[model samples]
Target: MYRSRPGATIKAIATDLGVNPETLRNWIRAAGAGHGRGRTEGAPAVPGSSVEADLAAARKRIRDLEEERDILRKAARYFATETGW
Candidate 1:
């Protein structure tokens, strides 16, 4: 699930899955280590880590939020005008 959603933080995923954040982190670490892709504690991110993907996901999320905000603003304005307030 983590690899599938680049925008999701570990905390968010852990909360959704009803698991502790550290437990989730450890699970991820173990999974990576099993695949020979894990990094040592305090080591830099591995090459497989998708920082670009995460950034793009974040930008997409921002855009979606902005669009929703704009729609709500327009709706509010329409309602206010209708009410003459």
Candidate 2:
């Protein structure tokens, strides 16, 4: 969704959508997910508090970043071994 775009701000998207910024923020917070989202086992997520789903998303992001770092490391080593001379 457009909301996930880089550098996208709440106020900007809300303006584009013809909605109040606070409302948009609430919608975003509400969408943090809950017991039925990606979590398989955890406490029942409260409506206003989506800690579980957010944690899951953060953990997945960490894994993705780690993978990207590994790829970059390999690329760096490959380029380092190549001599311009």
Candidate 3:
């Protein structure tokens, strides 16, 4: 589930799963190290591939959102000055 989300935090996930954040972090680390709960054949061998792609997409989306926010702020200032408010 955490791998599926772009900006999800460990604490948030732990809360959702009713587990401690550190516990979840440990699990993630262990999984990354190929420890605990043997991998299934269907699982992607290169986890970094999907994770990096997701990170890139999330970063791009963040940049786009920041740009939109800046534009909106500028427009608000323009309108405010135009109306002498």
Q: Per-prediction count of colliding residue pairs?
A: 0, 0, 0
Tell me the tens digit of each residue's lDDT in model 3 across 9-63.
Answer: 7789899999999998888776662354345666764678889999999999999
lDDT of each: 0.79, 0.68, 0.80
Name the best candidate (by lDDT): 3
Give TM per candidate: 0.45, 0.41, 0.48
Q: Please state the error at residue 57 of candidate 3 in Å.
A: 0.4
**Clash-forming residue pairs, model 2:** none
* Predicted candidate 2, C-alpha RMSD: 13.5
Query: Model 2: runs farther than 4 Å from truth?
Result: 1-49
Is candidate 1 or 2 superior in TM-score?
1
lDDT of 2 by residue, 1-85 (tens): 3334657677888898999988877766665532222323453435435677888899999999999999999888888888532
lDDT of 2 at 23: 88
Instruction: Point out the worst 10-residue segment of candidate 2 by lDDT.
Output: 32-41
| Runs off by more than 4 Å, candidate 1 | 1-45
Model 3 misplaced stretches (Cα beyond 4 Å): 1-46
lDDT of 1 by residue, 41-69 (tens): 66544544577788889999999999999
